[model samples]
Target: MKQVLHFINGKFLESTSGKFYDNYNPATGKVISKIALGSEEDVDKAVEAASEAMNGEWGNIKINDRIALLYALADEIDSRFDEFLEAETLDTGKPYTIARHIDIPRGAANFKVFADTMKSVADEAYQMDTPDGGIAMNYSRRYPKGVITVITPWNLPFLLMTWKVGPALACGNTVVVKAAESTPTTTALLGEVMNKVGIPKGVFNVVHGFGKDIGDRLTSHPKVDAVTFTGSTPTGKRIMQSSALDLKHLSLELGGKNPAIIFADCDMKKAINETVRSVFANSGQVCLGTERVYVERPIFDKFVNKLKKAGENIKLGIQHDESSDMGPLISKDHQEKVLSYYKLAKDLGANVVLGGGSPKMENGLENGYWIDPTIWTGLSEDSAIVKEEIFGPCCHIAPFDTEEEAIKLANDTEYGLAATVFSENLSKAHRVAGQIDAGIVWVNSWFLRDLRTPFGGMKKSGIGREGGHHSLEFYTELKNICIKM
Candidate 1:
């Protein structure tokens, strides 16, 4: 098995205690890599390095220099695109198609966008009129949070980590990133790229280990400035508690059981296709992934049939295969967790229309971490499947009669990260899209986002946003300046 090391203090190092954990490839269920597990002492040393970098080498650099460095990193990432793709695919068990076409490309795009946006915020001008005799100059000066701790998740590991790390670096903060144990290879590799691209030492660091040990040490450390996390809501809640102890500014982009409503006037076939694709994309392990579907009763029967037909066409294979439509959920343990939700939904009177059982491994995929893409219809609005966040490839559908009823059912869940509204009528789509209490709403479209748009969740789903110019606000602090001229 291959072994990966943590990037600490601009060097690759083993654990201080010489302990390691197995990192598996979900597709083959094989131990692909062994990662060094850090202790609190490692966290302390990394934080110390980050603090010095923030105030020493990184602090002395010009703002424009920082922005230019970001552009260079983006170029470097673009140049090494295949390396990231392979590392992400092997580490996270995501399809190489998505890792190459979606995640890596988007990560580069985020840095490129921030390269331009960062310069826009650096020394932006503001003026205030004086009541007395002289004209007054007033503006806000923004700077880094200093030694920010980014605690990331297993699913979509590279993409989400960039969402935090990109803007944090561009906004002038030095970062200590903690990639999930399930997928540490890509992060360690990304750290190598950051160091190679002439970025100052300690600008970016990566540590790998479990949350209960290393993650706890990082978040609870006094030197770490802020904790930005993307993961399950329960873990996010714990991070919040630890952040409170140090009064560190926190941004927790947590879980979701987002809903989608198919209006009576909607295109039934299109809605069914997008709904299935959205929930099952990334094996339903997305924070904004659509977990609940509410279709108008007028088209319920047709929707179910279309869903089953779509299920039969799914191609499950190795992550590198071009023929595969969906890949595994992180591991066998996670697969079982998602299947347990299936049992819960079954006991709640939901009717399974398509798949409910794991498939025989496709070709040589018998040992891979794979599960059948499943869907259920005829569920009541109050069923636990409709209300809870199940981060898996399972989807729940219910029928509603009126537009009001559809809206009510879609908005009933505690999660408000994302939702979709489908309608051929443009005005009705926009109106209902506005009414849904989600952070993001797509009309006849799902998972649509621009790098310039703000992305995040509401209610129990999460706190704060991650993209756009507003995202820089999270990584920066402002000091109001007033001067008499």
Candidate 2:
């Protein structure tokens, strides 16, 4: 049987239970492989293995050596780019452009950055001579969380995993990565690369199982010193509650219902282009993807028409085709859920401007799940379609006459993850951007991220943050040493 198995103890091993589930290719609706289904028992074994690896091999390693291992893993991944992309395409249903260019390349680069960063970490001197008083000295250093439980989501599995795994390993911590059931292939593939790069056995581990079955065990595992997760809000709540038993440290990158505003003084053409890219890119499955768009009354009609036309032009098909712009949703179940949201929009009296239905499977995707890029107009901030994180190619547009109204609508949602503002008036842009309650704001750009950039949400979106300046801090603990004389 074609199989996708777990990676444990630096080796790809068959399931302990010997049970496997169909791993389907969303674009073709075919079972590409049989992924081993892991249970709570499997999680326990994996955690125990990771714990041993941490205390034995990783715990004994020098800081510099750990950094070198991270750098080596990055180099190994860089060398096998194609192999990673092929497996990613099969597992995640993302297009070639995304798998080959975006996720894989960036993931490899992230490890390299972590490696370099780790090498430079040193205790900060906190001692100074006093003219006529006794000397006082202080310094700060880093401590690794012994073991981390990484619970990642389906979208951008490899890339998101790196944002967590990179820092965890760099800090001399052992890891147990639980990938989304639909997209565990690339992460599993990384295990081979990790071993080839010389990361010791038990230092790194990957488990394949549904979140419902194996999740609680990992989050509450007494041995787990920290938990880093990327998923839905409800799920994050559960993970946090479980970890509360031990009050384990958490790094959560959860859901978002982000917004983009177009001021009356904005350049309409530029706004339209960015609006399409912001909402429809990656089939709008991004956590930071724009779900609602607010426009000024003067240009609202023109912007909506242009955005509607642009949405209709998006191409959805197979993952391998270089010309194909969009691939299937991560799975059939997700595809159906996306369609249901669109259906609910109609029920709530939201107007579908263009391409509001599922993408036809006739276009080479005889079986995979695909949806046409869609747009909704005349939606209010209170509309269910506008407030929720659809996590699909769905964008709702609302018009505002005054600047204050636009700001109100932008910050109306419970989520405060990301937002965009477009305007010829720099002052106006800055003013509106400030009033918007997002963690990150774009003056003219959207969904732009640097490996080192701090990324996360506020309010119900999530707690804590990820990326740059703060990311490495999440995987470590700060201890201060002081002496007085």
Candidate 3:
């Protein structure tokens, strides 16, 4: 079995605690690797290294030099594209095609996009009259926020990790990354690329462990200046409390119980196709993935039937299988959690329109952590299945008679991460999308992202935006200086 260790100060080191956690492949229900479980001591070492690098060589490097290193890092990651693809697939059990086209490519693209954004970003300058009858000029200067502790989730581990790491590095802030325990392989592999690209030692570090063990230590560390986390709302709350002690700069992208509202005037085929992808893409592990769908009453029945057919067609297979459309959940524990929700939906009098149980597997995949892509209806709006973030390949669809009801149903939850409106009526699309409480609202499409746009949630979904200049704002501190002529 492979043993994955921590990458600290440009070297791979074993945990001082001598404890290890089994890294399982969801497709086979087998242990693929043993990851070192880090302790507070490990976090301290990584933080110390990051602080040293931030105040030393990395801090002194010019913006142009930093941009050059970022580009080189992006190129190196692109060069090893296949390696990253395989690692991401093996770690997450997502389809090879999905990992190849979306995860790996976007992960590398984040670096170049942030590098260019850093190059083009400008600060403010103001000219004012001085009280001494002389002219005064005020200009803004941005500096790195010091050691950034990044906590990433397991679903889109590579892409999301780089989303924060790219900007943190481009803005000249050193980072200590705590990748999710279940998907640490690709994150560990990136250490090799960091070294190969000649990024200075201690500028980037990775520590492996559960959130409770060392996560609290890293977030609460005195030397750590900021924390950017993408995970569950509960975890985000805990980190927020930890950050309150030092008032560290914190950016959290939390959970979402997103909705997709399908209007009667929508392009039927397009609405059905894109909504299906939105609900089950990456087995519905995406933070922006839609779970609660509200269809206009005239087309509700037809929409449910078409969505059911699409859910039935989803293929469940292991990594390297080109024929698979989707794969298993992240782990057995997650499979159990999702399955419990299915049972709850049934118990809550849900009308199961499609799969409600696990699918049969063969060729040594019988023990895999698999669940059929599920669809449900007839559940109340306030039901647990409809209100909570299950993060599974499932959705509970309901019908609404009016545009006002559609908006009400969509925004009825505490989470305001993302939503989709399918309407051919441009007026309704604009009007309904404007009323939805999500930070990012999509019309007639799902999961189409432009890196330059501001991205975050409106409510419990997240705090603070990232992407383009928004990310630069989070990673750096802007200061205004006034000088008299």
What tens digits encode model 3's per-residue C-alpha lDDT throughout 1-485? 88999999999999998889999888988888999999999999999999999878888999999899889988999999999998888889999989988999999999999999999998999999988899999999999999999999999999999999999999999999999999999899999999998899999999999998998999999999999999999999999999999999989999999999999999999999999899999998999999999998888999999999988888889878999999999999999999999999888889999888889999988988899899999998888998899999999989999988889999999999999999999998999999999999999999889999999998899899999999988999999999999
Of the two candidates 1 and 3, the one with more favorable TM-score, higher being better, is 3
Output the TM-score of candidate 2: 0.96
Best by lDDT: 3
Candidate 2 lDDT, tens digit per residue, 299-319?
A: 888888888888777777678
Order of candidates by lDDT, top first?
3, 2, 1
Please report, in order, the local distance difference test score of every candidate based on alpha carbons: 0.83, 0.84, 0.93
Give candidate 1's error at residue 345 in angstroms.
2.2
Candidate 1 residue lDDT tens string, 1-485: 67798887788989889999998888888888789998887788788889889888798889888888888888898999888889888877778777777889987777778767777755556676688866888778887878899988888888888888889988889888899888888788887788888888788888888888888888888889889999888998998888888899888887788888888788877887788778788877887788788878888888878877887788776778888788887988888887887888778877887677677885656777788788898777677777778788878878888888878878887778888999999998988898898989988888778877888888887888777677788888878888889
Window of ten residues with lowest summed lDDT in model 2 = 355-364
- Count of backbone collisions in candidate 3: 0
Cand. 2 Cα-lDDT: 0.84
Error of 2 at 47 (Å): 1.2
